[model samples]
Structures are given as C-alpha cells and as structure tokens.
Target: MFQETPQDALVGTWTNSLGTVWAIKADGTFQVSLSKNHRVDVWGKYTVTGDEMTIQESHGSHTPKSCRGKAIYKFMRDGEMLTFTKVSDKCKLREKNILAGWKPWKG
Candidate 1:
C-alpha cells in the first residue's frame, strides 16, 4: 500500500487558465505542459516545506539552460484550488507562471 506524506495532497495534475498543465509527483519532481497539445514545456524538481514550495527549473523547451534559478512561493490549497504567492523568484518567466495560480485538473 502506498503511504501518503504531507506533500501527497499536492501530488496530482493541476491546470491554469492559459491551458498550462502542471503535474506534481510524489518523487519531488514536476512537469509543465503548455496548451492542449500536452507537449512538455518545462521539467523541474520541487520541494515542499509546510505551506512553502521551492521550485528549480532543470529544463524546458523555451527556457535557457543558464536560466536555472530557484523560485520560492507560499502556496495554499483550498479544496480544489491551489494558489501561490511569490516569496522570492529571480526568474521572471517562472514567476509569471507561478503567480497565475492553478486548480485541480478534472481531465
């Protein structure tokens, strides 16, 4: 049987208004797919400590290798909704995506 951790509640697929699909896994990794085509746009690792999440982009189709920076945000999960408030993020593109927020993906 699979045991659930504190982060397990967040282990699932989430989507934003811009058709971005964010998949957070139990293995401390995440992937982002922009648009309905579902081609992975970004891949990275994330760590959650309490209500805060720190994300570092490892690779992306549109992200440069030199742009690997860690972004920290305070996250809140209210039922089916998930939102982020930036704590510190030097990467503008990444900050934009995080601020956009997400909801549980039904599909």
Candidate 2:
C-alpha cells in the first residue's frame, strides 16, 4: 500500500469553478493563473502548517502590487480534492476570489 504524505497530497494543480488554475508543486513553489488565456501568472512560495497554508509572493506579473505579500488560507482535503479558504486580507484580490472555495485539478 502506498501512503500519501501531507506534502504529496498538495503537489498538484487545482482549479476553481470559474476555471482559474492554481498549481502547487512539491518543491514549495507555486503558480496561479487567474484567466483562461493564462496570461495572468502569479508566482510564489507556499508553506503548510497544520491545517493552514501560507503563500508568499516573491514575484508576479499580473498580481496586485499591494497584495504581493504573504497570504494565509485554511485548507481541507477530501480524497484527491483540496480546498483553500483565504483567511488573510493581505492579498485582497486573491482572498476575494479564493475565499469562496476551490477544487483540486483533476486533469
């Protein structure tokens, strides 16, 4: 039997009901695409602490300059699906969209 590690469970692409995509790799690096064209790419680093995940944006093209700092979210997992609930206001725009809910990328 193969055991799934906490880190392993989070290493994949996730998308919202609206088609926005967010990818979290095993290396702690992440990418988020807010648009269908994939032009708005946000690059950042993430860390997992218990049930909370914190994302720190170091650089990005389309992300808000003011919301470029650290973002905190409460996460829960259901099988292969992961949901992130934004708890930090640092990334207001991100919080607004993601605060609702997101699902793991199946494809």
Candidate 3:
C-alpha cells in the first residue's frame, strides 16, 4: 500500500463556497480562479512543511504591487474538505480568501 505524502494530499483542485477554485499542483505551484468565468485570480508557488503552507504570489488580478510578499498559513484537511488559518500575512485580501475553506472540486 502506498502512503500519501503531505504534498500528495494537497495536490488537487478544490473549490470554495464563493465559487472560487484553487488548484494546487505537484510542482509547488498553485492557481486560483473563478468558477463562473474561469478567470485566474492569482498564480503562485508554495512550500509546505507538515501543516504549514507558505505562499508567494507571482502574479494576481488585484493589487499586483502588494501581492508579491509571502503569506504563511496553517491548514487542515478532513477527507475532501480543507481549511486554512492565518499564521502571518500582510495582505488582508489574500488572508480573507484563504480562510474561506475549500472542498474537493468535482470539476
């Protein structure tokens, strides 16, 4: 039996109640998009250590100037559901969006 790694558990597409989709890849990269229009809101790289995730946005739709900084979050996964708690983040918008929680995206 193959045991899933921490990265493996996080690698997939998840959607929030706000109709936003977050896709986390195996390459340490991630993208956030809107489900309605499929417009990418942000794209970035992330590193995970245990339950902690650090995200550094490479590009985004809003406040591009302020989005370059790294944001740290603590996340928990329960089956198909995933939730995040802020550890340290200077960007309020990013923090708000991430705290919304997510579930596996069937799409």
lDDT winner among the candidates?
Answer: 3
lDDT of 2 by residue, 44-64 (tens): 898888788888664677777
Per-residue lDDT tens digits of candidate 3, residues 1-107? 99877777788999888888889999999988854777887898999998898996658765456667988898888988899999998887777778998999887
By TM-score, the best candidate is: 3
Model 1: per-residue Cα lDDT over 1-107, one tens digit each: 98656587678999988778899998999988876888888899989898888886668877754548788888888888888898998777777777886888887
C-alpha RMSD by candidate, in order: 2.3, 2.3, 1.6
How well does candidate 3 score on lDDT at residue 74? 87
lDDT at 37 for candidate 2?
75
Q: Model 3 scores what on Cα lDDT?
A: 0.83
Name model 2 segments beyond 4 Å from true. Answer: 1-3
Considering lDDT, where higher is better, how would the candidates rank from best to worst? 3, 1, 2
Q: How accurate locally is residue 45 in candidate 1, as Cα lDDT from 0 to 100?
A: 95
TM-score of each: 0.86, 0.81, 0.88
Q: Work out how many backbone clashes candidate 2 has.
A: 0
Clashing pairs in 2: none
Native-to-model Cα distance after best TM-score fit, residue 22 in candidate 2, in Å: 0.6
| lDDT to native, each model | 0.82, 0.76, 0.83
lDDT for 19 (candidate 2): 79
